[model samples]
Target: MATSTLSRWFHGNVGMVTSVIAAIAIIAIFQIINPFFLSPQGRVTLVYAMSYFLIVACGLTFVIMIGSFDFSVVSMLKLGAIICALYIDDLGLMVIPLALLACTAMGFINGLLFAKFKVPSFLATLGMSMVIEGIALYLSRGFLHIISNRAFRSIAVTFIAGLPSIFYWALAIWGVCIFIALATPFGRQIYAIGGNPTAASLCGINVVKKRIYVFMLSGFLSGLAGILYMAQFGGGSIEMGADMSIPLFASVIAGGTSLAGGTGGPQRTILGVILITWTQAGMSMNAIGHDIQLVVFALIAIGMSILTANRKTMSIVK
Candidate 1:
């Protein structure tokens, strides 16, 4: 009885437990290597640097939890930034909403292609990525478009309690997501659909509609992240979102959200984001090259995937 009870508890809480331990371990190691790793400035920089990615991961967490993938997250981010830059002069503060609306539209199209046309989520998102990238390149003309709007730039630079304003944005978004995921019927339905779509449909869940909403949310967050990125950097470029897949996916997976779905939430992704951010910060402080950092991220992702692989749900991943 004791063994059985212990086993059940461990299995139920493995993701959270492991992530917590891993995060603590990483922080400890890094702090040892550089005594300043936990200093006030360093902590603020780490959170500020990770704010946008954290926001994106929060949105992606929903999509992943529903047993689907959104490959266009990075592209959507780039598109949003480009759109914001293109119209910032004319729209001023309104540019943010307009850009987000565009991204939401793009996500809706992705969902429509998947849920209505029977296209696989992977392929639908992949194709959308290409479309977004093409649009971004054309609009930017293969050059960086500087953001001249002071009000828009202030969004990224404004600090509250010594942390970037974007950090608060990330926190607020995550809070809402957590509430939705834990306290609402919609959240439960997402897990049900992910765990078994046919069964969820039989139980009267609107699988298709929910899936579309998931993608729309993902797109909205991606767009928000893009705007934040532009504000932080003072410009938008076609390459702004290049090669973001690894870190974003890694953060989700490492945080305990399985690609197989139905197993994680926004809270887990928060831990994952912090871990990845800390690792990257440590590497940068240690003078590690960007290429080597990518390798580190890839390896961490692979290891986490292997650790979290749910053999029983392997068939459901498709």
Candidate 2:
């Protein structure tokens, strides 16, 4: 019976462990290919790349927990950056709060439509995302906004105790989100809604409220990620976060989070983002082109999705 129990535990959690191992392997490979990948400067740079990815993944994890997919996260990220850059000269830190608030409002709108109007989450998010992107372009007039503030700029580029500030932000965000997921009443409600909305509602969970909160969390995180992007780059563009959509989603799934919702945590997603960032940075430093790197990541995401699907089928059969 002990052996049987051990086997069952392994079967259930092997994927999570394997993904961590795979991430470590990728880091090792990067270290081997570019000795700089292990050097202090290189390590900090890698973490810098991982920061925004981690932030976006955190928000996506919550949204996915409610069994809803959000494609507008990238657009929200871009919008936040645009807003921060456009207003920072006049507003300084105030821009940060305003950008986060805007993203939250956008999420609230999406959630309201999804829950009240019965619009499919995917379609609603997609349409909202386009609208956001459009607004970003209009504000920028198809140009980049150059950010000149030294203090805010340091938020991404400065090193704190041998780590990038963005890295610290990523860690803080993950830590806080994990705490909420594990300890908060809202977090419990989100999981319940994700696991089974109908049953959760029957059990007195306010499914609509939970969904709104989840999306709001997603929006806020995306906004913060955009701000980080601007700080890191010293400027922003409507295109700043356009390429992050697939990679952010891929990181969540690769980290063993269920897209069907109610499973996984920010910690797992962080591991996944770190792995992908390491892989991308290592290749780039070694002179590998962006096209090849993206293709490889796409393939990895596909494999993980297949694995997740097969595992679900096996569970049902059992």
Candidate 3:
């Protein structure tokens, strides 16, 4: 009877349990392989790596939870970073709004294309990414832009307690996402829509509006990530966030937020973020090359997708 109860609990909380196990195992393996992994400096490096990533992944969690995709998340982040780098000297604090507004607009377009025109979410966001990428490249002239603004840099780099300010920002945002997902009426609507769009619409949930708003929320968070990233690094370029797409997707899925929708939330993403970032950190400490890391990330993304994307409703979302 005890065995049966444990099995039932495991099945019911599979995502949570799996994510916890994977996160713990990753920490253990990395700590052993690179004794520096738990060292003070190594811990700082790990936090920085995951902080910006967690900010962006929070947005992806919302979209994925609703059985949708947003490939433009990374591109918009890049664009936001580039915008800040290019205009920080001129706009100072105001450039933030400009960057955020641009990202939000792009996200709105994504929503319109997918919900209004019936474009596949993946295809719609992919196409939007192309356009955003072009704009970013043109703005930066395919060159890296340095940001020398000490005030701007302080936004993310200033140490607070034992960690950087960006770490706190990421943590704060994660908490907000959790609250939004688990508490608000809007949150319930998100799960309802993801679980059954037709029923949600019939039940007065305003599926199209909710979708557009969700995409907009995604855009907003992605932009916030970009701004924070630019501040933390003191520079930006078109390539800044280019390779992040797969990792962020994997992080969200591995966190057990089902791509099938309505099964997970940001609460799980923190563990997945820790797991993936530490793996990368461990690999880097061992002198792993970029090529190897990309390959590994791709495999992880595929594996996680298989585990989380289990419902036919996922296919119908487009």
Candidate 4:
């Protein structure tokens, strides 16, 4: 009986246990390689670097948890930043709301294409990403749009107790997501749909509606990340978010969220974001090449997949 109980406990908590262990091992290795890797300044820099990505990761977590992929997140980020920059001069603070609405609409369209038209999520998001990228490029004429608003800039740069203001923004967003994912009925429904859509639908869950909501939330958060990115960089560029999907996906998966879905949440994503961000920061500190960093990220994704694979549960691995 004791052995059986132990087995059940380990099975229930294996994801969290493994993720925490991996994070600690990586940190220890980095710290050994570079003594300054854990310095106060290094930690602060790591947090700042991860702030925007965390926001994006939080949203992506939901989409992934639904057993769907969203490749348009980078495009949404770029589009949101572009939209905000284009109108900030005329609309002032109103640009923030306008940009978010535009992003949400883009997400809604993705949902419509996937849920209503029966287009595959992967293809729908990929096509939408291309279209959005084209729109951003056309609007900017393939040039950077620099933002000069002090108020907007301060949102990213301002420090509170020695931490970037954007960190707080990310934390708040992450906190809300955790609440929604764990405490709300909507959250439970998401897991149910992801676990078995047929079963969920038969049980009276609105699979289509929830899937749409997931994409919309993903878009909204991606837009939020874009706005923050513009604030931090003081500009918007067509290529700003081109390569974000890799790290964002890595963070979600590394944090213990199963690629197969039906398990994991914002809490797991938080740890994953920290691990990936720390890895990136460590590489920078150690003067590792960008190409090598990309390789490391790829490995991290592959490692997480191997670690989390459950042949019994993963019916269709994407």
Candidate 5:
């Protein structure tokens, strides 16, 4: 009975337990290696790295839990920021909403294609990603568009308690995501679909509609991250939001969310974001090469995917 109880407890709490342990381990290792890791400046930089990361991961957590994928996250981010940078002078604050609307629309299409038309989620989002990137490039003409809007920049850079406003924004959104995942009926349906779509449908859940909403949520969050990125950096360009696929996906998986789906939450992704971002921060402090960092991220992503996957749900290749 004791063995069974322990097994049950571990199975239920594995994600939280592992995430906390991993987060602590990363902090300790980094602090020891870099004496300045806990310095005020380092802390600020770490917060900046993790904050937007958490923002992007919020939507992804829901998507993963709902058994879908959105590869267009970074692209949407770039596009949204580009839209903002191009028109912030003309549209002022209105451009922010405009940019978000554009991203949300893209997400809606992603949902319609996959949920309504049976496009593979991966292929659907990947193609959408290319389309969004092309739009962003055409709009910006591959030029870096810098914004001089103090008010807009202040949205992300305003320091509170030694951290930027973006930190609080990310934290608040994460809390909302947790509530949505654990409290709302919609959130429960997401898990239901992720766990077993056919069973969920038989139980009266509208799987198709919910899947589309999930994609839309992912798009909104990704776009929000892009807006914040623009504000924080005072600019938008092709240079920003490039090659972040590994870090973003790896952060979600590293937080103990199963790649096979139905088993992770934003609550866990926060820790995962901190772990991956801080590790990147630490490695950058140590003068690690970008190529090496990519390798490290890829390995971590692959390893975590193996560890957290629900093998029973995966089909045999043969």
Candidate 6:
């Protein structure tokens, strides 16, 4: 029995082990190629970049957990950043909550269409994403806004105990997500609804309500990501979050989350994001072009997809 339990724990945590191994291997390769690759400044930049990807991945994790995809995450981030920037001067500290609320509303709308109206989550989110992109373009007119407020600036620029402020926020959010997934009744409901909505409904879970809640939470986190993105950029544009949806989704998949439904958590998604982000950072520092980075990421993602696909088969064979 003890051996069996140990095996279960190992299987469940294989993704984490993979991420650590990847991280260490990448560090070694980079160090060999460029002695300064693992320097203090480089490590700081790594954590800085990881903070944004981590927050975005956290939001994506919630959506993936519910067996739904939101293609509009990048758009949502842009919208949230623009909204927060617009209000930071007038609303001061309130800008943060207001932006998050707007993000939640957008997410709720997406969820309502999917959960209540029976619209497919992907299609609905895609349409909403287009709408958000259009609106964001209109609001900014393709220009970057330089927010000069000290309060807003501090969120992204300030640090404590040598850690980036954004890292703290991401860590806090991650803790909340961990608590939800591991301890909360609502979190279990998300897993149940994702794994089998029909079964969940029969078991007295309000599937629609649960989905809406998850979507709302997803949106709020996306918005929070935007705010953090803005802090890092010292301002933002309509293009702030462009091209993130695919990578974020790929990272979630790479982290060992099954797309067919509920079998993963934020831990997997965050680990995947860290690996991808580090890969990108290391490659970019090495002068690898964006095109090459995309290609490499695609190949890696494909390999991980195959692994994810074979998980059930591997289990059965064992």
Q: Give the Cα lDDT of each candidate.
A: 0.88, 0.82, 0.88, 0.88, 0.88, 0.79
Instruction: Give the C-alpha lDDT of model 6.
Output: 0.79
Model 6, poorest ten-residue lDDT window? 309-318
Deviation in angstroms for 128 in model 5?
Answer: 0.4
What's the lDDT for residue 91 in model 6? 88
lDDT of 2 by residue, 66-88 (tens): 77788899999988999998999
- Model 1: what TM-score? 0.96
Backbone collisions counted per model: 0, 0, 0, 0, 0, 0
In model 6, residue pairs whose N, Cα or C atoms come closer than 3 Å (at least 3 residues apart or on different chains), thus clashing, are: none
**Roughly what TM-score does model 3 have, to 2 decimal places?**
0.96
Instruction: List the RMSD of every prediction in angstroms.
Output: 1.5, 2.8, 1.5, 1.6, 1.7, 3.5
Report lDDT (Cα) of residue 58, candidate 5: 88
Give candidate 4 misplaced runs (Cα > 4 Å): 1-3, 313-318
Model 3: lowest-lDDT 10 consecutive positions = 309-318
What is candidate 5's lDDT per residue for 1-318, written digit by digit as tens?
999999998886675577678779888988998889999999999999988879999898888887777899999999889999999999998899999999999999999989999888989999999999999999999998999999999999999988999999999999999999999999999988888888999999999999999999999999999999999989868879777989989999888777677888887888789878888999999999888988988987887787687888854310
Give the per-residue lDDT of model 4 (tens digit) for 116-178: 888888899999999998888998888879999999889998989988899999999999999
Backbone clashes, candidate 2: 0
Measured against the true structure, the TM-scores of the candidates, in listed sequence, are 0.96, 0.94, 0.96, 0.95, 0.96, 0.92
Model 3 residue 53 distance off true place after TM-score fit, in angstroms: 0.2
User: What is candidate 6's lDDT per residue for 53-149, written digit by digit as tens?
Assistant: 7877777787777778788788888988998777788888788898888888999999998889888888999999988889888878898788888
Judge candidate 3 against the unseen true structure and give its global Cα lDDT, from 0 to 1: 0.88
